[model samples]
Target: MAHTTDETLTVLVYSDDRNTREQVRTALGRRPAADLPELDYLECATTPAVLRALEKGGVDLCVLDGEAVPVGGLGLGRQLKDEIYGCPPVLVLIGRPQDSWLAAWSRADAAISRPVDPVALAEAAATLLRSRTAGRAPATR
Candidate 1:
């Protein structure tokens, strides 16, 4: 769908589990911050769905559940970075702090651990959204 200048940023969230996706949506609420655009989530349950969402364009940022089945978020994030031109900043949900290296390897822009803390998730997502918004080309709006 074409994004209009309605002050809402598109956030693509991928997770194999419904509960995991719900937690992410709840934590993010309507917007990560007042300074950032209000979020409109595009939920994806599979790797193919994620790819399709990204392909549709106007994705301001992505939140990926690293524990997702089959193709995990980290692996998908890497693929996205490799293949998508001007990919949006990605925030990965990790299983462990030690997996930070893996997140980096995936070329994720930011990460937070599971049992997600609402504050931390919101803050991290907001940071990425702000950064991506700032870096956007003039016609992005």
Candidate 2:
């Protein structure tokens, strides 16, 4: 089943490697599930680029690359959770399956392993977005 969003869901993918970022974009673009309309990916290859994009204010979810050299996605995810107000749910891609625990430690909403699976990634993204959308409240604290 193809994924389709009710409204456009802006996804931010953070990876230092150009190929990894492109791979993610390709995965998302290929087959949007029935749930989410075609995904709109905002790709970022640097920490500052991710932050800068967020500041402009259109991201609905975040997919981060945990294996990125230097500053990894786990660290980036944690930083966004801490610094960004109402930080969006984060999905981290761990190159090592063993590091799934680390993804939990980073408090990521969900994760996908590297050598990515387009279907799984799309499903996970859709699930997380649906859960988040369903959890919204009236802003009364």
Candidate 3:
């Protein structure tokens, strides 16, 4: 899909830890790839906030923290997948590479292990965003 330069994609970042959210935003920057549209981020520090933001719509992608307290992103991701009429692609932040299977169980579109590798995070996010721009249907569980 060809995106206009003026177009900006909205990415929702959900993490209870402030640092995790900041890291994601910093890693993604203004745009993950030159071809994709610029990014606008919406940070949610709580599960309720994440749900509320998603309900309002307009989110192109989601970066969720799997290690978050009370309700983890993996569970939340699953909830979004099952509940949301058309949930946006979700990129889950896992604690280790081996936890990728858990990410799959959560129905996340992509998974990245923290301490946030800027290159990998950007690439994963960019790919999901591009898929969104291409109007690809969300993957089924």
Candidate 4:
């Protein structure tokens, strides 16, 4: 992904579990690898909140939990892709690695299995940000 000095990519993380969201935030804060730059994250606990936030502000990437209540990340990801134009790239967290194909079906750009590895989460987020900067439309409409 091509990046500029002034660019601060925004990531929206959606999960029903507060602790899971915290883990993602902490990992992102660390900026594990030297290759990927630091970014800002907007956390959302519910689907409606996610929509409202996107309407109020723009985002570069989204990290969604497949197990979230009401609407799982994969389902939400697909809905966003279909309903929104130029949705940001999505990074989904499936319950297991076996569901990778399901993630693909949802049109998620990338996915990782839970429990998440800190380094993997950071890498995935960076990759999504890079993809966003590279002209890929975001998954949110």
Candidate 5:
């Protein structure tokens, strides 16, 4: 898949908290890296919304909040990896650095601790996006 400059990649941001979703969108801005196409975010505050968006397809990446209530990203990420065919790369936000092992268990492509450092989030997101666009398999554990 060749992406042109005009193409905008779709990124799915899943969190029950509106603030978390906003933080991710703001941190990422219009584009995470200059080499990648601009991003179009599909924000989902509920699990059903997330499922619908993903099932409908065209999501290039997933950013899930580990602290989200009802269902955390770690469990959700694991489910997506297990269930969704050709699931896009997942970046999970963990509560602490120590939870990186949980991220590995979830099978996320990448993980970052929350308080959502803009720089780290951007770097991780850009890396996953690059892999997605480049037709490379997303890294596992």
Candidate 6:
């Protein structure tokens, strides 16, 4: 569903590190675009938490940290893409531009590097959000 002007989009951000999650949240802000709905974030610090959130649905976009431990976001993104029907568009944060291939392998819709640039992250996130909400207003969170 395409997000309406007032509906808040549910964004799932996954990372073992809290700071990384915070960075992502900060970069994306409450509304990436004047045309889009406000963003509401769900932070996940572990794999199971991520899955649990996804299973419940309503996630418009996912920002995954590629450097997470035990299980990196790249692998997790791939798993979610395969396991979750209608999986939300994924925007992965990698350590380097060279890792873009990994993000592609993970089936992420977009990829950006660490030391997150707010402009880039916001742009990428907005693009994915738009793609997901292309034809219907997003379901309320």
Per residue, candidate 3 scores C-alpha lDDT tens digits across 27-107 of: 999999988778888999899999899888889999999999989999999999999987999999999999999999999
Model 2 per-residue lDDT tens digits across residues 8-119: 6678888888899888888878335665545677888888998998887767789999988788999899889889997888999998789899998888999899889998
Once fitted onto the true fold, the runs of candidate 2 whose alpha carbons sit more than 4 angstroms away are 1-6, 135-141
Clashes of 4: 7
Residue 107 of model 2: what lDDT? Answer: 87
CA error at residue 40 for candidate 6, angstroms: 0.4
Please provide, for model 5 over 91-125, each residue's C-alpha lDDT reduced to its tens digit, 9 standing for 90 to 100.
99999999999999999999989899999999999
Q: Candidate 4, after superposition: displacement of residue 15 in Å?
A: 0.5
Per-model TM against the reference: 0.91, 0.84, 0.92, 0.85, 0.92, 0.94
lDDT of each: 0.88, 0.80, 0.90, 0.81, 0.90, 0.91
Taking the tens digit of each residue's C-alpha lDDT, what string does model 4 give over 1-141? 444455466788999999989988887783535554456778899999988877765788889999999899999999888877878888899999999998999999999899988889887877767666665433332
**Which residue pairs collide, candidate 5?**
none
Q: Measured by TM-score, how close is model 2 to the native structure? A: 0.84
lDDT by residue (tens digit), candidate 6, 41-133: 999999999999988888999999999998999999999999999999999999999999999999999999988999999998989988898
Relative to the true structure, candidate 1 has a C-alpha RMSD (angstroms) of 3.7
Clashing residue pairs in candidate 6 (N, C-alpha, C atoms within 3 angstroms): 1-136, 2-136, 2-137, 2-138, 3-138
Judging by TM-score against the true structure, name the best candidate: 6
Q: Which stretches of candidate 4 lie over 4 Å from their true place?
A: 1-6, 30-37, 135-141
Kindly provide the TM-score of model 4 when superposed on the true structure, using C-alpha atoms. Answer: 0.85
Candidate 4 whole-model C-alpha lDDT, 0 to 1:
0.81
Superposed Cα deviation of residue 37, candidate 4 (Å): 4.4
| Residue 73 shift from truth in candidate 2, angstroms | 0.2
- Residue 112 of model 6: what lDDT? 96
| Error in Å for residue 107 of model 4 | 0.7
